[model samples]
Target: MQTLNTLRSDARAIFDAALRAADPRLAVERVLARRGNHLLLNEIPIFDFTRGKLTVIGAGKAGAPMAQAVEAIVKPDDYLGAVNVKYGHLARHHAGVISNSARDGVRAPTKFILLYEAGHPLPDENTLRFTHSLLSLLEEQTENDLVLCLFSGGGSALMEYLVNGITLADLRVFTNELLRCGATIYEINTLRKHISQVKGGQIARLAQPARVVSLVLSDVLGSPLDVIASGPTAPDSSTFADCIAIVEKYHLRETFPPSIVAHYERGARGEIVETPKADDPLFARVTNVIIADNKIACDAAEREAQQRGYAVQVVSTTLQGEARELGHDIAARIKHAPTRTCVLGGGEPTVTIRGSGKGGRAQELTLAAAIEIEGDAELVVMSAGTDGTDGPTDAAGALADNTTVVRARALGMDAHTFLENNDAYHFFAALNDLIITGPTNTNVNDLMIALR
Candidate 1:
């Protein structure tokens, strides 16, 4: 039988292999190709570059690396595009990042392709500018032009152009309020679609007559195109009525900004046109291809686990609900599994903050598991975000085992108090158990592993 520490090492190695398998560069290189003079996406001819130019526009946490991969494939002179990525993505690379430079501020190879750093998990002033630049680029497109869009997680807050009368302040307030209120990505994006001039297939509308091919890296569970980054290119199935329901569901109708509420009110009343729907003729020229997802990541990890002689079972790919609660449940499952077995789960979970604590969902989940698995020295559990960030913390997530809680108590720390305050980062940091792989440039979702 494998020792507990050996199992922990194996689990982390499997998780890292999963991230490598989901790399955007490989994903793009697999799906996109230039055959002779024609551009093909997924073996289907998307454009005749002889008659039209190949243009690109995209936004997400992985936008920079995705764009870089496309740049390596396409004719440099033929491709002109811009991408909006999170702030720190452009400035740094850690040990895990493959880089030509040893220091920060590494320059990209694409001279014509522009990359802008924007906010994430929350929009900032630069977010509007990023979306506006993308919109302006689309306006320059012609019927013969082909639009290549790269999308991944973190695009929702990275690029946003709010509706008129909805100021940036209102957007910031609404986003902050809804984030802490425990609304799901679907619910939060429902509100965003109604308020944003750039999202909800509006990008497609603006790029009309131009064939749009979107290569998406799925972050949301099940790869629902309409929910990923608020589906800026894919047709939106949601309506203004849906936005109101989400607002009411979170009790943000009254507490949210006034102008924001009024915009939704007008949209609900049909004073403004709805986002493009499934039956809309505008979707005729658009194609959305999900090139990577959480299931793909999980499947890769499962292969790695089995190769190591562990009986592997993917518990769930659509794992959701409270972070702490899920940690407990997954720990219980590990205890029940056969000896030398690995349990895996992937999906973004929500955290309902009961106290003012500093931690991400992945950290909170690991800490909770630590407490639940107390005294069971044969088990190890770990959870991490694929993008190398969990919430706003520098570490991706945490790893804990049966003795984790006892270790904390020996150090005079209360694991329950830290978990309650949503402060798992500090707890794990003191334990020296944080999984710190900075900026993987790929995001499918969170992956959790338990070995018994």
Candidate 2:
């Protein structure tokens, strides 16, 4: 008899395989290569070092390793700039980052670019500072320059520059409102572009005349270029009217600050310029390449599941909707699924917070699934973020087998009460069921796995 513990281990191994496939450094390395006096991305000659000065800039959770990938191809002396990453994401690249002050009056010679740690899920003080640093670097570039931009999940918050009249405080509040209302990443980023000077192709406009190449690791479902990191280097298909429509759809105007409401209103009235459109000549110099995404992660999971001796089924690559709802749907599927089978899924899910609870979409979904599949010995389900951090909690997500509820009850814990409070973190913590892989240093979205 195969125990749930064994199933859980297999599921975790499969998840780990998915993370390895989505590694930001490896993803960039696969597409980027160097040749004698020339550079190639995906085997096409894209850059020539002798033509101009090379400047690298970007923002994301994977920024540090992506920078390391670029460094592997471009000499540190040949390129210089900065990238804003979420706080504590600079894994093992401490020697490569330029610090604020030199303790010994000598900076590391290998340090050509600056990596500034900033707040995430929302922009903070360091976000503003790093944005200023990157813009100033762009200001020094001329027609004979090459700008390489790295982007991945979390870049929207890791990098930001507010448009005039919209304060950081207002932007933070507006972002929180959008998140709590279950707004999609596309809609949230659409609104972000309107209020930020550096997003929605504005960065490309700023780097004009200089050729810009952006290597993206997509976290959004469907990988719409304009929505990722609010399309800092891609054309914006969304408009101010789109922003207004999103607000009206969510009834967010009432909760939003006056400045936010006024800014988009002015933008719609032609008082402010819209984000760069697809026809904009500025985009002629920009190239956005997706190096990795959820599909790649899910495919890896499928292969691993097969290697583990389970019949595999890829459920979906574009999964969406509310977390709790998706949880129930997944549980029902697993219960009806054939024995010795592994069902794999990938996509970002939304969590609409109704209580003062500490949990992300992945954990919330797993909790709901646990309740639905309680008392069934033939199923085990796990959902986790590839980035290794779910929402604000330290745990990436959670793993629940048929034994989950029973184990919780033995410890005097109730799944329904925790679910009601949106407190999945504590619920899983008590049972030691949380999948805690701290900062896998990459993001392609989330992965859901079930085995029976």
Candidate 3:
């Protein structure tokens, strides 16, 4: 009863369920509510609405919708906020404009939070500008104010403020090098914390004297509070020494910008103040809460597959390592899986760029998987990011089945050649198998679904 078409459709359905579970708005709503002139987080009153002016701030792919969720609970003029998101990811309101609209049949003048679009996976001039603006807003807060930090994945790049001597160009160059070197997000963010003015709890420090609460939609596996989006509103368990170690571990000293190297070294030597540590007293007023993560998405995928009559196995939520190797391993597992089984894995995998290839981790994984499942008709694999983006590609990810490589071969494309070149985007595009879902407005790592 499990035909190829059925399996493919079921797999997509399962992934969609996972996306819904990770919806930024719903996730925020689940943890935040207002009860009788007090803002309650998880039923505990954190802010007295009558005593403080509310301000929402932070950045990420989920910033816009997360802001919307907060807006739904608070009055329009009660809070002023700003968030930087990746390009094309915005809520219903136009950027930087306040528009009036009716929600739930109530005519309300919505004070649109400043949602600035900027580059992601890499920082740009707009990233710096937005960070400065956020700092200015933070400076305006007083003890009689409430600050909510809406943070998620991509925030590290979407909201950045360089140190005194480090230029935006320097941060970009080092970031590109760190990404291509297959360094983990933790390691990359360790470096990012040292060079930025507002990361690793620095933002929390800036918003001092005001009660700061962060609602996080985590993209990092294990949802480490200090690692996700470089933990702008959390504590710093990572240090300057860790940053130098990551640079040396990746062998990026030569390629990293000179100012970056100096910055890290200076911080390590205590010439510069380190990021706020876990023991910092400033953290007493700052509370970081993760409302959604990869496990939530993977669990949702499992339930959907089960509803579809699949013997679902959520393999792992902390999936990592080399993308291609993971793909091949997944393909082998699916080959031996039972006829009506669905296997789900979720996490952000790493890809070391050895070639001038143009594909993200998800695409590369699918292409490698295709080569392994070649000529087998009973298996299908789909790997994609929840954020609707994989690396720099337009596609969320790619889909591959037994016929993927065979079809590519017919079209004069060799799977091995493309895999070797890290050109899975083009290879999948040729077969019309790329999964394009532009900016899902959320991030919880990625999901890999395989059916047999």
Model 2, residue 162: C-alpha shift (Å) = 0.4
Model 1: residues with Cα > 4 Å off, grouped in runs: 91-109
Task: Write the residue-wise lDDT of candidate 3 on 1-452 in tens digits.
Answer: 66888877887888899999999989989999987898999999999877888888878999888988888877545567788788767754445644221111111212457677778988888888767777777776789788899999999999888889988888889888988999888888898888887899999988888999999999998999999999998888988888888888888889999988988888889999989998899999998899999999999999998888889877799999999999998998898887888888999899999878789999999999988999886789999999999998999999898888888999999899999888889999999999898889999999999998
Q: What is the lDDT, from 0 to 100, of the residue 444 in candidate 2?
A: 95
Scored against the true structure, residue 89 in model 3 reaches a CA lDDT of 74
* Model 1, residue pairs in steric clash: none
Query: What lDDT does each candidate get?
Result: 0.86, 0.87, 0.86
Residue pairs with backbone overlap in model 2: none
Error of 3 at 384 (Å): 0.2
What tens-digit string does per-residue lDDT give for candidate 2 at 1-452?
78777899999999999998998889899988888877888899877788878888988998878887788776545677688877767755454654442112112222576777788887787788768877888876777788889999999998888988888899789878977899999988999999999899999999988989999999999999998888999999999999899989999989999999999999899999989999998888789999999999999999999988899978899999998998998998889888899988889889988888789999999999999999985699999999888988898999999989989999998999889888999999988889998777799999999899
As a TM-score, model 3 comes out at: 0.95
Model 1: ten consecutive residues of lowest lDDT: 98-107
Candidate 1: C-alpha RMSD to true structure equals: 2.8
Model 1 lDDT vs. the true structure? 0.86
How many clashes show up in model 1?
0
